[model samples]
Target: MTAISTALPAMSRRDEIWHGLRDTFPMMVGALPFGVIFGTLATAQGLSPLQVMSMSLFVFSGSAQFIAVGLVTSSALWVIWAATFIINLRHLLYAANLVNHVRHLPQYWRFPLAAMLTDETFAVMELRYRQRGSEGYAHWYYLASCIGMWLNWNFWTLVGLVVGQSFPDLKSLGLEFAMVATFIGIVIPGLKTKPLWAAAITAGLVATLLHHLPYQSGLMLGALAGVGIGLVLDLRRKKLEASVYE
Candidate 1:
């Protein structure tokens, strides 16, 4: 085992903080336009500023917030809850990513990381840990990334609120594309893995085939199918590995 450093000298802390700040900038830039759009839309949909900011702060998930706004407009609490549950289901994936990297950390550390986790932070942490093999203050690095994201998310959300009042054409600003592109970029790379590829394709096909299902239930079904297929593939992989050793 690599020995832990006895003390994090001054230079190391500075470097970690620097790395954190540098990595955070791009995400902040990307969030600005999207935040503006969400803010404007919430206003258009008749949500009070208090409601918009409340959702932004407490829910802290854009997709879920968007879905919630739609349901609130329609006054369908049950559907809103159901859709929010489905859309935010990706949190499970984020948790899985955290498990891979920080599961070895103390329970106290791991639990907090899990609570603060977001898709971007999870992706960044996973990428860095995979590349660097989790040495040299990795926990701090992950914390830095989360701090950056949390700040960006809240900051741009506030910007959105202010801009939403001033600019009625926020949707026309086309900021939503950034989020679409980000998710696509993250997802496309996973296709390199056979099991993941199979799961993704199967899920997409199932979702499309069931698109006509009532009340968009197919989305939940697709997620379930994808997760099930992935788990089965993982079991087969483990069985094969055991056979080789036996």
Candidate 2:
């Protein structure tokens, strides 16, 4: 009985990791074109293949990387840095939502997991934690999702870099549209609540109207607006529930 009890936890952890990998497969597929496009565009923008791969390996942010590559020539170093920083502000919210669940984890586990956290991985982690509760080795499951995405991004980046060297016109191939479809897939499934729909519609309209803004500031503005709208609505709903109970 003692031996069985000891082994079961280990077995369960393995299962959690497996499930994490399995669930993130669709997101990985959605990210495939974006990774390849980033690699190709970075190289075409005069970044060496090593620099391109290094960005994917270390930074691991698809949108920020794309923006960086796009502005590498036209913008100053500080401007590029600031643009990427603004683009990644959403990760702050992602990390905040997860802090309660991961606060107890050791530094070693927390640091790498935090570094590897991305939109898709965060989505997978949030869904799993909602359904399974973060009781056991849930961090291992999060780690699995992160590692799968890291490997996939690197592999496709390499393929794109190599192929871009030969084709030179790879960007015109329309592969980037895959990323749009993928983002829609990620967002649509999560819009089950009224707050979500309001946020999405608000952001979409705001972004569309401000699309002419430089450095994609419109995107950031729209995101902030959406978040603000969602928060206010959520708080009001909570207050109404409290008053009803009273």
Candidate 3:
């Protein structure tokens, strides 16, 4: 208890809020290029500025928005939905893990936090929860982090729209790779365990092999297969550990 107490910083609410934004700044930076790329692609896809801006404001999922941009004309509606849903399945795990920490909060607080929650927010918030054990004004930190990311994304999306409109071929500049780079940074660090390894590797292989499929169905299939395989392996591992303990 003493060690844990000493390890967790005792900071003011203002400090926590600042730390939330300050700590997440790198993640924000990583995502900036992605935001610009998305805005460029969406506008290039013939979506109006209002539509592009609304998507950023409301959807806010970089991965999903990118999928929508690529598939809006080529893929069916159901395919887009499935692709986004599969990509976002990780958020379910994120929410489940963080639920206990915020269970004491009112519905109003939990609702917005849930809505604004992203990979970056979850990464930082999980670390914060671990360090502080959910004490102090941690949710304020969460809120501020969300606010910072949300604003960053929307702002860049607008910039992309403006620049892409002027250039009209910004998407052809081989810039979409920024999303790939950002995602690699976000995902690679989390593949410490076996299940995560299986999921990522399997997803990549399957998505690659099935890339010829129409409507970007490969992504949905690969993601589903990877999640399913990872879950099975995780469950088996847990059962084996339990039996050993027993």
Name the best candidate (by lDDT): 2
Tens-digit per-residue lDDT, 1-246, candidate 3: 245654656778899899999988988887887888889889989899999999999999998898898889988899899888877777787899899989999999999999999988998888778777777788889999999999999999999999887887766777667657766877887787999899989999999999988656787788878989899999999999999999
Better of 2 and 3 by lDDT: 2
In model 3, what lDDT does residue 80 have?
A: 94
Q: What is the C-alpha RMSD of each candidate to the true structure, in Å?
A: 4.2, 3.9, 3.5
**Reference-based lDDT, residue 225, model 3:** 86
Evaluated at residue 205, the lDDT of candidate 3 is 95
lDDT of 2 by residue, 1-246 (tens): 243423233337888889889999998998888888887888899999889999999999998999899889888999989888878888998999888889989999999999999999998988877766676888889999999999999999998899888888888878888878877988898898888889999998898899899767888899888988988998898999999999
Clashing pairs in 1: none
- Full-model lDDT for every candidate: 0.73, 0.88, 0.87
lDDT of 1 by residue, 97-203 (tens): 56766767998888667766777777677666665556557777777777777667777777777777888777885778998677677778767667788788888
Most accurate candidate by TM-score: 2
Work out the TM-score per prediction: 0.78, 0.90, 0.78
Error of 2 at 176 (Å): 0.9
